[model samples]
Target: MPVHRQPGPTAGATSQLWPSGGRHLWPSGESSEVQSHARGHLVYAANGVLAVHTERGTSIVPANRVAWTPAGFTHQHRAHGDTDMRIVFLAPSLARLVPDRPVVFLASGLVREVLLALTGPRSYDPAVPDYSRPARSRLLRVLVEELSEAPEQPLHLPEPQDDRLRAIARLLHETPADSSTLAELGKAVGAGSRTLSRLFHDELGMTFYEWRTQLRVHHALVLLAEGHDTTRTATACGWANPSSFIAAFTDIIGTTPGRYRSGRVVQDQIVVAQDQEQGSDRP
Candidate 1:
């Protein structure tokens, strides 16, 4: 009375699934980059972290996070340092049920099993729709419910809205590493230092220094997602040194820049270079 699972897709079959869809297992030190030309699929970071970014913003998806990307978002994704990853591409039809937002869900044991099954050959059965399977069905329900709930800890850094605060915000966004004091920023933005400090307090609800730190950290994340290493990313973002960058990144992102770079390196190893070379030779 025991259940039997069929062997998964053969190596040749998996190769065909590449460049479009498949379940891929990435051990430490494997990485890939991809540009989505068609509909953006649903992706789950089964383990480790996956960094995703677009013009709107950047987000780091920790283990168990579910990201729903709409079609043609122009984003890059990679695994976090020294961690294994299992990524499966959901079909376009199934992707519509979720919102076009990045969400990190608490993965239950049942959800974990369902995610594992998605990577197997059963997912490719033409006659068997992804949602038709019992596990898949349950997972869909959970995902919908979680999306409806607000995040326990919202992930966005606060932005200032007052006129003087807006000026400072613009400067920070444009040049995150510019080490100008409040007085200098105020003068450049046409406000007095005390006036700007009052505006920062009223609008952003944080000190000027605190708000600038948030901006710098967010900017650094964007650079890292683009495949820049810690040393370069830190220097470009205006940190005095790599250690300063690491401290800020760790404080805000809960991981060091080096670790973030390591994940991308792994993903790049697995997916980007060879694929691009192959495409170049095709013609």
Candidate 2:
């Protein structure tokens, strides 16, 4: 079963207006209606996590990451946990600086600060000096430069094109906790394990386990947004123990479940430090 829920904002959601961007505080599970923008935009989840669903795929935007959607693509935003969501739209000229397709980028400390400032209270406060067009442009340019310098994260879960793969994907989406092996799942989808594995690599560019991890992470984020405890979420996502789940989640998300659930600023700096030590961002 696809995780279907009514689209649009739920009760208790509040937004702050800004010309170039805005800030939205959403309760857990709140989602925006499927919509398209005239200009490409970047979305960041400062406090919680966000899933940006587009026709191409879904991009997971945790505190350590930012998601960009190119102009004219239909997309929807869903909040995981109590989310402080920020949005910044780019002009046609600036939008050209980024990829035409939707992508997720690692959020450096500078990028996070710039996003907050662009959509912060200063934009709407009469007493505060607002970000002039040129100033905002500079900030946006900084964002583009920072993001462009690094490789895009593998946070996108691409939608498979094959019918057999789609069938198998649906099974996992409906019940992420299902511990079925590839051969077992292959039997239901009418494809041999070897054939399905080849299709996974050829179509989705990942192994079966890799794809399932992404799905489980997506589901886990939603569950956490609904106030599910880490242990419950871990078990629900097919992890036998919370320790294993935390290790996996932290490796991908750059933060532990405890900190993420508490809505604290993630230890993204730690990830940055590790990247710096490695001497390459592409690894």
Question: Considering summed lDDT, which 10 consecutive residues are worst modelled in model 1?
Answer: 7-16
> What tens-digit string does per-residue lDDT give for candidate 2 at 1-283?
0112232265667877555777788987789889998989999998878999998889988877889999999999988788899999888888888999999988887788898888776775666777766887788899888888756887899989999999988889889999899999999989899999999999988999999998898888778767889999999999989999999988777678877777653565546656786787565
* Model 2, runs deviating above 4 Å: 1-11, 268-283
Scored against the true structure, residue 229 in model 1 reaches a CA lDDT of 83
Expressed as tens digits, the lDDT of each residue in 1-283 for candidate 1 is: 1123333232221121333345544433344555664655545555455555544344555443445556777766555443334444445655565556444443433445555565545555555444445666566556445444523222334545566776777777788878989999878878889988888787656787776776676667556655678888888778899998899877655457776555543343224335755899996
Clashing pairs in 1: 30-266, 30-267, 31-266, 31-267, 31-268, 31-270, 32-267, 32-268, 40-71, 80-263
Error of 2 at 71 (Å): 1.0
Candidate 2 lDDT score relative to the true structure: 0.84
State each model's CA lDDT, in order.
0.56, 0.84
